[model samples]
Target: MNLFADIRALVISALDALAAEGALPDGLDTANVAVEPPRDPAHGDMATNAAMVLAKPAKAKPRDIAEALAPKLEADARIAAAEVAGPGFLNIRLASPVWQEVVARVLREGTAFGRSEMGQGQRVNVEYVSANPTGPLHVGHTRGAVFGDALASLLEYSGHEVTREYYINDGGAQVDVLARSVYNRYLEAHDLDVDWPEGTYPGDYLIAVGEALKDKVGDAYLDQPEDVWLADVRDFATDAMMDLIRADLALLGVEMDVFSSEKALYGTGKIEAAIAALDEKGLIYRGTLEPPKGKLPEDWEPREQTLFRSTDYGDDVDRPIKKSDGGWTYFAPDIAYHYDKTQRGFDQLIDVFGADHGGYVKRMKAAVAALTDGRVPLDIKLTQLVKLMQDGEQLKMSKRAGTFVTLADVVDLVGRDVTRFVMLTRKNDAPLDFDVSKALEQSKDNPVYYVQYAHARVQSVLRKAREQGIDVSEAALAGADLSGLTHPAEQALAAKLAEWPRLVEIAARTHEPHRVAFYLYELASGLHGLWNLGNTESALRFLQDDPAHSAAKIALPCAVSLVIAAGLGILGVAPAMEMR
Candidate 1:
């Protein structure tokens, strides 16, 4: 069903035939050859660069190779013409049956039409939204959550065994601060005057955890010292905050396959083992780092510390694994966490991080590279900040989550689907301005609304077809006479459908889920464009006077809905059966 791939295979066969006839040099590398949609539609339906790539390698002029190869491609039943364009580019116009077959294949495959086997069921671990479990998830974490969740779904759809993971930052000092914050709220629940201290969480979300702590052990810790109750309170508060985080993620249709705790790595041989593994590779040593380039920190001093030779694997400088105080640095646990992932037997790893963590990317990648000896590849995608606005005014902090807008607040205002879709409308590393009013509006300016409206329109056409006594089932439409679908608009729509499978493979290989969102928008626009064309052209309408003709026309919209549903499913957004 991938017309591009089929055409490329034909070009390769033609090249092999040419080489056998001694018309070209043998063993020419065609791996770089590509078949794709031509830049200008006027040129042809497809274009290939086979002749251009093989020209220098075969010691022949590109145009000579193209002219010889064109005749061989024209002999194929699917190719109407193969013209040599500009030096060596082969522009091909496909026969009408090629476009007709695209519609039929879409109907036959349904939602599985665009599914790819590029992954070959390889295991992939995607870790994201690894926020500190101190309070409800904030606006920054929401972008990572949506992006990571969508990426996991996309990999799964492309035939990878994906494990969605969240690495909880409960091992850090933040949890102790959370425990103290909860204790203050516990005192407030007991009617005692409690002063909110600096470095402690002040969000109202912790007030409930404080009250719950009071209910669980009333007056037990009222007079206890910090040493006596710090452990219990930290565990209690962390559990409560984790529960809140889970609810927040659920609001956006996100659920992790695994919740790994950084605290669990402490005192457990895991950190030592990960560092020891690097040490064996001569990557770990005790060294003093030079002053950072450009600007020096006020506290910068020469201090001996345990460092990982990250520069060996492409980092700018080796990074510290242990601070001067002899305790593990933050990077230590991260390295151990990735090592654990490697031990789990993943063929590849992807980490979705906040844009602020840009400095940590190279070191982390180096650690994984040194640990797995480059057997596994790690791709870290950084999601930039999200700016939320409403009614042309910037929204400020949320009192509930303390400093920033909580994910819950955004989900409550618009909705889960709208929030998820809007977060992905831009590239992950690019900042996004999320306007509440614009997102909720039912207009083309809003991609979520526009794409959903297209799906609903297709459903409406199908409903109308059913009511007109036409058998609009996939079996009936797939078997209809698609040769009548020869109109330019109809043929163009089918050609767009042919790009889905190839797009899926490209997106998966690049590990960019935003590409899927962009492609879905383009596909929806194509459907909408065709639907608008039918208003003035009665023959372009989905329902016709003859039942067979109506079935054939309705098949195109039905395929559109199927592909939209599949694409939205990858994004974790439910397809709209009807626009509200």
Candidate 2:
């Protein structure tokens, strides 16, 4: 149960009642009315701006309106007091039983306590980690992978039908380079001397793919010309690199529901169909783009070409769909891919891209807007760079990846849970400094450790209670009388638990999964704070002389652990059963 929502509904009902009693005018819009935790907890449990928002529309003073509404709200059993704070804000303190019931509700719902139905089952397609299938995924892709996967989970928890997808960049010259790199490795596998060429991959990871190719076709393509082997090797090498990427993602607990191929869009009418759809709306034209701002390039020329009127949809300029040579431009396939997504009947689309692709955001949004006629909303999230540090210095590049650290290397060093949690410690558009030493630390400085320790502490308490012959099963704890949980510390922690469902909806609506990580850390801090309080106060301890009393006290931590586990699940991190 969302106490904030329930309280907001109560505030609306009070305003309606005031209207009926002639204390306020009728038909005041309450859409902007909100009930949230007070800025200062000392003010009240919840605060509302209903009086302030309705004052102008109701043709009444805010304080006058708040004064009239307070009595109507206090008449309800759940509301202990409603006081006008400042000039118009209404601060509400709920009855003590209300906070106690929040704990019991958490136990009954288990990890499902904060799950919301806000999306109403709308279909959402989340495309992320669409890195070129050239080699194993690197650190940049790792951030996008973690962010996208967590976002998909968050949407699912908030009742959106989500599809995790990866768009393979195989239709470009990059795959040809991959094929040639593998061919060099294939020659080395035969114990032959081969000169490394410019613009080809030199990663040691390709050594295995080269050896595997030899095993599959023994001497079949040996010493062959480019035409004879390029096509076959391109297909083979692309498949091998994709397998490596999949394994890398698995190391971090990410699995995609679909892997779309850029090459698949070619040799088909998909690109033409997508362009035709835009053309039908008069968004496609033959035009020459103006020279880019600043010093013009040596090869800059105003050439008439097939272009999409992206400016119509807020892009900086009209984008060319075809190059001067008559081949499809790089943006053509991307437009086609997004058009296919719109055709799939998804109500919404989300793309997780690396920070370097920030310029591509507007054009992609324009394409989807033109394709769907603004019917499907598209959100593009750019994950910024991750600076991997150890020993106060940046980590060296991976030998396997040749130029950057691979995702597997990070996961192998600090572990999957640590890698996933730490990646989300910062906002997606903000740069993150991931220190390996800090991530592995067992102190409060490490957010992942701190959060996990809270869950493990709850488990420890439950185990101690069970050993003492106090029944602490889900049903028993849920049914326990929580009336004695009146300590200020206990009430504060319960209030934090009541914010879970509301936080879920806010994070999901904003498409920000990092908020979940932040909330989990706050909740963990509250749990740990209360746990520390029990050391001095005999009444605060979970284990008391009376078994029934112990049961009642243990119920709060049980509820805390349940919420922590639920938050961790959305982040794709497994909750710690015990801290090592």
Candidate 3:
């Protein structure tokens, strides 16, 4: 259950009652009313904006409204004290049992405790990691993959039916380059000398694809003309590339629910159908786009082209959908793809793209807006570049990728868990500094290790308690007399435990999963601080002289472990039971 939401509802009802009693203006809008944790602990447990939100509408001073509303809230059994503080804020502190109920609720709910129905079961499609399927995915694509997968998981947890998707750009020139590269390898497998030419892919990952092609066709196309073999090779090579891409994603624990192909859209009338939908809405036209702003190219000339009136939907300018040659532009198929998504009956759309695609965001959003007629919202998340560092120096690239590190190299070096956690330690738009040496270090400075270490410590405590014949299972702990958890140190942990359900809602509303990582870190810190307290004060220990007290004290640590396991589950990290 969301305690913050529960308290907010109570505060809203209390204000409405005051309005009914004519203590305030009639029909005052309470939508702006909010209940949040007080900035200063001295203020109280939760603070409300009842007076601040109603001051202007009620034509009364904020403090006067707060003073008038205080007693109404104080009448509830949940609020022990509701005092007006600092110019109209009402800080309310409840009795210890009020928080005790929060702990019991969490234990009963388990990992589903923080799951929210905020999305109201809306449908969402997340398109991500649509890397050029020309070779094995590199390190940059790895970040995008993890970010998209985590975001999809977060949305699912927040009560949205999510579809994870990847758009294959098989219609582009990059696939032709891949085809040529595989052809060279095919010749090599046939005992013929071949040289990878300029602008051709030279990655070793494609060598197997060529050998397989040779096996299937028995060298029938070995000496064929370009036109005769280009299409076939392109199709064959793109399929192989996708196979490699899928395996690469599997290695990193990513799975896409759908894989849409651009080439498939070409002959299927899907592109025309999507464009016709836009045309019906009067969003399509034939026009010459103005030369790119600020610096016109020397060869620039106005040319008539099929354009989408993107500016009508918030883009800087209309974008071209058909080239002057009458062939579809790169963006035409994308608009079609998104229109296809809209037709699928999704309620929302999210695209996870690299930083270089910042210019593409506006047009994509405009397309979705026009496609769904503003009924479905589109949110684009851009993942910034990750600078790979080793011993404070930039890691050098390999000849295979020309100037970039491969994803396999990274996974092999740090393993997938460390790589995933460290990548998510920052906001998506913020650059992540992944220092190789630091990520591998098992110290407090490493957040992954620090959080995992706290979990391991809790496990150690539980093992110690069990070895002494103390019952520590959920059944036994659920029946513990938590009243013995009266020590301030133990109570502090219980308070921290109360924040999870609230934090999940906040993070989900903001569409920011990194907030969960930050919350988990703070929770880990609080647990570790309480553990240190036990060393200095014997009474603070979980194992008490009285078995009844021992069970009660152990409940606090047990509760902490449950929340940690849940948080780690969301992060896709394994919670260590012991540090090795």
Candidate 4:
């Protein structure tokens, strides 16, 4: 049960009563009315804009409307007082039983307490970590992977049918370069001298792929030239690199539901079909793009090319779909891939890209809008770079990746849970400084540790209660006499728990999973504060003098543990049962 929503309903009922009594005009649109926590806690528990929203429509003054509505709302059993504040805002203080009931509701619902149906079962496709398959995923891709996976989980928790997908960039020259790199490694596997090419990959990770290729083909391709081996090896090497990427993702607890291939868009009529759909709407044309604003390219010359009229859909300029050579440009396959997603009957599409791809965002959205005719909404989230640091210094390049820190290296330095939680400690578009030493520290400076310690603290309390023969099962806790939970500390915790259901909807609506991480930290902070409060107060302890009082007191911590577990599950981090 959402206490905020329940209170909002009560506010709406009062507004309708005012209209019925002719204190307000008939048919006033209350859709803009909102009930939320007041800005200052000293003001009240909740605040509403019902009077301000209806004032002009009802042809009455805002404060006058608030005065009429306050008396009506104060008559309700749940509302203790409804005071008309500063203009037309109504600041409400709920009765003591209301906050006490929130605890019982949490214990009754457990982890499902904050799950929302706001999405209404819409199909959502979240595509993230579509890194080039030339090598292992780097630290930048790790942030995108964690953010996308958490977003997918948050959408699912909010009642969406989420499909986690990865788009493989295999239809480019990068795969050919990978094939040549593997060929050199294969020659080295045969104990032959080979010169390393300047542009080829030199990572040690390819050594295993090269040796595996030798095991599979034996001496069949040993004497073959580049022409004979390039095609076969390109396909073979791309597959091997994808396998390595999959294993790397698994190390971080990420598994995609779909892996769409860029190469698959070719040889199929999909590219042509997508373009034709846009062309039918007069969105495709052969035109020369103007030189980029402010600073033109050194080779900037007017050349006619096939372009998509992306400017029609709010893009800065029309983007080329075909190069001067008539071959498909880099964006052609991406257009087709998004068109395919639109045709798959998804109501919403979300792409998680790196910060460097910020320029691609407008064009991709324009293409999807032209393809779906604005029926399907597309949201592109750009995750900024991650600066990997250890002990006050930046980590060096990975020997396996040759130029960047591999995702596997980070996971090895810190376990999967630490890696996942620390990655989300910052907003996606904001740069994150991930210090390995700080992330693993068992102190409040470590957000992951601080949150997990709250869960562990509750577990320790439950274990102590169990040893004392207090029945702390969920069934017993749900029936506890929570009326005695009138301490200011206990009430403050229940207030924090009431924010979960509201926070979930806000985070899901904004497509920001980092908000969940932030909320968990705040909730953990509130929980830890209450735990410290029990030091001098005998009644504040979980183990009371009476078993009945203990049951009532333990219920609050149990609820805190349940909410923390639910939040951690959404972040793809397992909750700690006990802290070391």
TM-score (all chains, Cα) for each model: 0.98, 0.99, 0.96, 0.98
Off by over 4 Å in 2: 297-299
- For lDDT, candidate 2 versus 4, the one ahead is 2
Q: How close is candidate 4 to the true structure, as a TM-score?
A: 0.98
Whole-structure CA lDDT of model 2? 0.94
Candidate 3 stretches greater than 4 Å from native: 398-402
Q: Local error of candidate 1 at 265, Å?
A: 0.7
Task: Please state the error at residue 348 of candidate 3 in Å.
Answer: 0.6
lDDT against the true structure, per candidate, is 0.91, 0.94, 0.84, 0.92
lDDT by residue for model 1 (341-413), tens:
9999999999999999999889999999999999999999999989999999988789797688999999999
Q: Rank order by TM-score, top first?
A: 2, 1, 4, 3
Which residue pairs clash within candidate 4? none
Across residues 17-130, which tens digit of lDDT does each residue of candidate 4 receive? 888887877788888888898989778888999889888888889999999988888898988899998888999988888888888888888899999999999999999999
Q: What does candidate 2 score in Cα RMSD to the true structure?
A: 1.0
Best candidate (score: TM-score): 2
Q: Listing every candidate in turn, what is its Cα RMSD in Å to the true structure after a full C-alpha superposition?
A: 1.3, 1.0, 1.7, 1.3
Which candidate's lDDT is highest?
2
Model 3 clash count equals 0
Write model 2 residue lDDT over 40-159, tens digit each, in one string.
Answer: 999999999998999888888999999988999999999999999898999999888999999999999999999999999999999999999999999889999999999999999999
Sort every candidate by lDDT, greatest first.
Answer: 2, 4, 1, 3
